[model samples]
Target: MNYWLVKSEPFKYSWDDFVNQGVGTWDGVRNYQARNNLTAMKLDDLVLFYHSNEGMEVVGIAKVVKEAYPDPTIEDPRWVVVDLTAVEKLPKAVTLKSIKSDERLQDVSLIRQSRLSVQQLKKEEFDVIISKAYEN
Candidate 1:
């Protein structure tokens, strides 16, 4: 399955809010690249939910429950969204600082394109982040 990371400001839509809602429609993407990433997602693809802005950390895991569909929140036909369900909260939230400090993650999309709301991850990169979260 493909791995991806999606960012949302905690104050706007935190991990708790996602778990409470059960399933969320990941929408409001306007960028061409980010929109394309959303369109590339497939059912059951794993996603890392990151709290951008304030926290700047990876907080939880989610999986695509539905593939790309016309974004209901906007009139623009170019935008689309996917349905995601919370898989689990990470054992520990992996901070951006931690990721940046790791030599293995230097080339990660999170670092290469910090401003992108949606990013893809290599399987090895995804595994490293997961390992970090579970570390003592």
Candidate 2:
């Protein structure tokens, strides 16, 4: 399965909001590259939920429950969204500071393209972040 990172400002959509909703649709992507990443997602693909702006950390894991479909929140046909369900909250948040400081994640898309809200992650990078979250 593909690994991905998706970001949202906690004030706009927090992990608690996601879990409370039970199922969430990933939408509002207007950027070409981020839109492509959304389309690339497949059912059951794992995703890291990052709190951008306020927290700047990976807070939870989610899984794609449905493939890409036209976004319901907008009238624009060019945009699409995927249904995701919260899998689990991380034992601890994996902060941007930690990720940037780690040599293993230096080449990750997250670091290289900080402005991209949705980005692909290599399997190793995904594992490393998970490890970091669980680290004491």
Candidate 3:
């Protein structure tokens, strides 16, 4: 299964909100690269639920419940979205600052292309981050 990371501000849609909701459609992605990433998503794919702007950390895990579809929240046809189901909350959030400072994570898209709201994660990077989440 492919691994991905998607970002949202905590105020707008926190990890708690996602878990409480159980499953929800992920939308409002405007960038072309981000849109492409959404389109590539498939059912059962794992996603990192990231809180951008404020804390800038990955707070939980989610699984894609549905593949890409035309975003319902917008009138424009350019954007797409996917349904995501909350999997589990990270014991400790992996901050973007911490990720960027780690040598092992140097090649992660989160640091290489910080502007991309949605991006693919390398398998090694995925394993590393998830392991970090469970760390003390």
Candidate 4:
């Protein structure tokens, strides 16, 4: 399954909010690249939920429950969204600082394209981040 990372501001939509809601419609993507990433998601693909802006950390895991569909929050035909259900919260959130410090994660999109709201991750990259989350 493909792995991905999606960002949300904690104040607007935190990990707790996602778990409480059960399933979340990952929408509001306007950027073409980010929109494409959303379109690429398939059913059961794993996703890392990151808290951008204030926290700047990967907080939880989610999986795609539904594939791309016209974003319900908007009337625009060009945009789409995927349904995601929270899988698990990380034992320890992986901070941007820690990721940047790790040699293995230097090439991750989170570092190269910090402003991108959604990103694709290689399996190795995804695994490294997951390992970091479980580290002491």
Question: What would the TM-score be for candidate 2 when compared with the true structure?
Answer: 0.98
Q: 43, model 3: CA deviation in Å? A: 0.7
Q: What overall lDDT goes with each candidate model?
A: 0.97, 0.95, 0.91, 0.96
TM-score of each prediction:
0.98, 0.98, 0.95, 0.98
Candidate 4: global Cα-lDDT?
Answer: 0.96
Expressed as tens digits, the lDDT of each residue in 59-130 for candidate 1 is 999999999999999888999999999999999999999999999999988999999999999999999999
Model 2, C-alpha of 39: deviation from truth (Å):
0.4
lDDT of 4 by residue, 1-136 (tens): 9999999999999999999999999989999999999999999999999999989999999999999999999999999999999999999999999999999999999999999999999999999999999998
Clashing pairs in model 4, backbone N/Cα/C closer than 3 A: none
Q: Write out the backbone clash pairs for model 3.
A: none
Q: By TM-score, how accurate is candidate 4?
A: 0.98
Residue pairs clashing, model 1: none
lDDT tens digits by residue: candidate 3, 58-135 = 999899999999999999889898999998999999999888878899998899898888999987888889988887
On TM-score, the stronger of 2 and 3 is 2
